[model samples]
Target: MEISDLERIARDIRRRDIQAVYEAGAGHVGGEMSVIDLLAALYFHVLRIWPDQPKHPDRDRFVLSKGHTACALYVVLAERGFIPEDEISTFLQPYSRLNGHPNCNKVPGVETNTGPLGHGLPVAVGMAKAAKLSSANYHTYVITGDGEMQEGSNWEAIMAAAQFKLDNLTLIIDHNRFQQGASLSETNDVAPFRPKLEAFGWEVTEINGNAMAEIVPALEHRGGRPHCIVAHTNKGHGISFMQDRVDWHHKVPSKEQYELALAELSEAL
Candidate 1:
């Protein structure tokens, strides 16, 4: 798809994500906004999978490691035909399969359940290693929050991926700079991610996570080593007042705020 089309789809995903959070009265909206473009680029343009056959052996694997942003992933899955778009409205409702975090068994496209911090990368490493062992051509991708990087498990997974020489693995850190309670700088400063990753034997690329032009090419690039994309993005990216505000991390938008945010996203669409 054209970059323009991908941008439009990303905007639409943002719009739906905001609405879902507003309706659900609960969600990690800031992280959701920050990460939507990456999800759009992956599901719409980069991933090779069948919505009808979600478990197809040769399909590319994607794991949303920062699963608090599942609302955005849900919208992308709906847009990409993996699930019913109407099902999005049921988000956060009692008994709804679309919970705050993704569940691989319940969701068609999700490769594994993820919500607890620092788990996705290890699972993705396993998948990539398995593909290598089986001589499968499929590649594996996982996205992690910058705050989530503070967990020691991610570092361990980085070591394992490098040791295994899992060249087919791609890890994207949603470097939005904010976590649940405070900014990443205030909490665990994992900035200067490139050198740390390179030292671990991985190739690193940095890009504006919100820009479709940058996102597509970075995701498409192949290499001999495991790749890490440090995607610098803004928390609550599209909406004006919410942008970069840590409180918006999971706060439900007020009626007026919702209208204004919807207007901004609509204009982008």
Candidate 2:
């Protein structure tokens, strides 16, 4: 898909994300907005997925480690035809597959159930290892929040990925600066991510996470070792007032705020 097309899809995803959160009365809309562009680039430009054959052996894999942002993933999956787009309205409702966090078993496009911090990388490493063991050509990708990287488990997986030389694995850190409570620098700074990842023997690429042109190449880049893409992004990318505000982490928009957000998103389309 063209970059313009992906941009349009991202805007649509943002609109759905806002609507879902507004209807569900709660969601991580801030982070969802930050990561939608990256998700759009992957699903539309990089991932070799079959909507009807989600379990196809040769398909690439993706794990959303920062699972609080699952609303964004659900929107992307629905737009990609992995699920009915209308089901987005059911987010967080009782028995709805489109819950606050992703459930791989229930969601057709989700590869692993993730909500807690630091889980996606480990699972993605295992998937890459399995592919290596079987000599499969599929690639594995995982996205985690900048704050999520503070978890010790991610380091363990980083060590293991290098030890196993899993070149097919790619880890993208959604470095949106702000965490739920405060800015990453104010809490536990995980900046200078490239050096740390490089020290662990992974090739690191830093890019503007919300830019489709930059995102596509990073996702598709190949190397002799595990790759890490530190995607610098904004918490609320497309909408005004919400962008970079820590308070919006999980705040449901008021009626007036919702209308403004919807207008902003629709304008991008």
Candidate 3:
């Protein structure tokens, strides 16, 4: 797909995300909005996988570390045919497999269940290393929130990934600078991640995480060290008023706010 189409798809995903949140009465909307472009660019363009063959042995892997934004991942997966697009409406509903966090057993495209913030990278590392052990050539990708970097488990996995020379692994951090209750500065700021990651022996690429042109190249980079993309993005990227606001972390919008958000995202399409 063209970059222009990816941008349009990201906007559509945002529309779907807003509607799902409004209907379900709750979600991590702020983080979902920030990461939709990265998700769209991955499922639509970068990742080498077939929707019909969800468990294909040789296919690339993606673990959404920040699984609270599963709504956005669901929208992108639906758009890419991993699931029915209409199924997105069932988000957060009782008996729906589409919950706040993704489930690998129930969701076709999800590689693992992740919500605790630090688990996805370790799972992705195992996947990448397994490919090596089997002499299979496939990449492994994982996306984590910047705040989640405070977890010691992630650092442990980072050290292991570097020690094993798993260049096929790519770690994309959604550096939106806001977490659940407050700004990263107020909570725990792990900013200037590029140097920190590089010091740990990974090649770092920084980009405007919301920009399609910069995203593809960063994901496609083939370096000898385990890779990291410090994606600088806004909290609620596409919607005007919600951008960078910490209060939108899990806050539901008013009916008026929802309509305005819909209108704003619709214009992007």
Q: Which residue ranges in model 1 land beyond 4 Å of their true spot? A: none
lDDT of 2 by residue, 99-153 (tens): 8889989999899999989999999999999999999999999999999999999
Query: Which model scores highest in lDDT?
Result: 1
Clash list (residue pairs), candidate 2: none
Clashes of 1: 0
Prediction 1 global C-alpha lDDT: 0.95
- Displacement of residue 38 (Cα, Å) in model 3 is 0.3
Tens digits of per-residue lDDT for model 1 on 19-94?
9999999999999999999999999899999999999999999999999899999999999999999999999999
Checking candidate 1 for backbone clashes, the offending pairs are none
Question: On residues 1-269, what C-alpha lDDT tens digit does candidate 3 reach at each position?
Answer: 89999899899889999999999999999999999999999998999999999999888999999999999999988989999999999999999999999999999999999999899999999999998899998999999998898888999999999999999999999999999888888887778898888888999999999999999989989989999999999999989999999999999999999999999998877
Global lDDT scores for all candidate models: 0.95, 0.93, 0.93
Candidate 2: which stretches are off by over 4 Å?
none
